[model samples]
Target: MDAKSSATDAKPAAVDAKTAAAVAAAEAAGPSTGESVRIDSWIWSVRLVKTRSIGATACRGGHVRVNGERVKPAYAVRVGDEVRLRHEGRERVVVVKRLIRKRVGAPVAVQCYIDNSPPPPPRETVAAAGIRDRGTGRPTKRDRREMERLRGLGAGPGGPSGGGFAAQGRPGDRDPSGGRGRPNGR
Candidate 1:
């Protein structure tokens, strides 16, 4: 009885191992040839876009190109195509290395494409914008003036005419000429 029970257990274990191996092999092989995936689906699957819908939206918005030509979302993508996507103020250029139709982990997604994108532009060092330190009392009159001056809203050496919103005047301030028409009269 013990021998028979062990044989049964061994058979199931062997089958499980075989199944796992087959799945792994499929993943390693990637999508088979003759099976095409949509451009949007491919981009989303490979982590080029946040979501499949966003990929489609980018395609419709003319932000995605394949091999230097604009393509629609449903366009078929094959291996070895150059894909250029303009997204979020930068362009991502990649060559398709593998074809996948489902979103995968970051590690796996990266293997699907060879990134040829240019180095991103260096971030400009901008001064902190009006962030007051915590627990500081309200700005004094001088501090207020200084803040306004830094923001180009203060009266400069040339007074309010120094090219900024200050010269535009408050929305409620009426024209001194008592008319709202353009100076040259349309």
Candidate 2:
């Protein structure tokens, strides 16, 4: 009964070698969405968005790009490749670290992607004409009523109900579609 030998023999030498080889292979591939990662899955794995659907939505919405051109979810992102993402009102650039096809943990997500470029300078922003920001921060009850009073969204196709689009509906509740009213505009 050799204690050291017994422990050593618990695992087959071949199994140990196989495990070591698998780990080495995974490490060689770098970070990925999972054991095997696709570009879209990898992006989802990296804490970029809350879900894979959001990542795909961003891509379909022209918010995701490879280099300078918009790419679809099927795009194969690899190490060193650049990815541009438009989130909220800002654009972010990231580099691929590894490809993982499955969802990953937060820490693992960080390893799957890299930041390659900084967002654009804010000074160059140009607010679209006719539309103006009433204010920032959460809207108070009074503020909501005031915004409704000064509704500024463009009008639906034909003329607005009583006034024009900007004049008739509330600022954030413009009825773009003919169906429904302001809040529930279809």
TM-score of candidate 1 against the unseen true structure? 0.61
Best-matching candidate per TM-score: 1
Count the clashes in each prediction.
Answer: 0, 8
Range of the 10 consecutive residues with the lowest summed lDDT in candidate 2: 154-163
State the C-alpha lDDT per candidate.
0.83, 0.66
Q: Quote each prediction's TM-score.
A: 0.61, 0.47
lDDT of 2 by residue, 1-186 (tens): 699887778768766676556545545555534333455566776767768888888888999988778988877776777888887677778887666555555545565577765756676576444354666667775665455555655333344534555445666773466446545453
Per-residue C-alpha lDDT of model 1 across residues 38-154, encoded as one tens digit per residue: 999999988989999999999999999999999999999998999999998889999998787777767567767899999988777557756789999899877877888788777
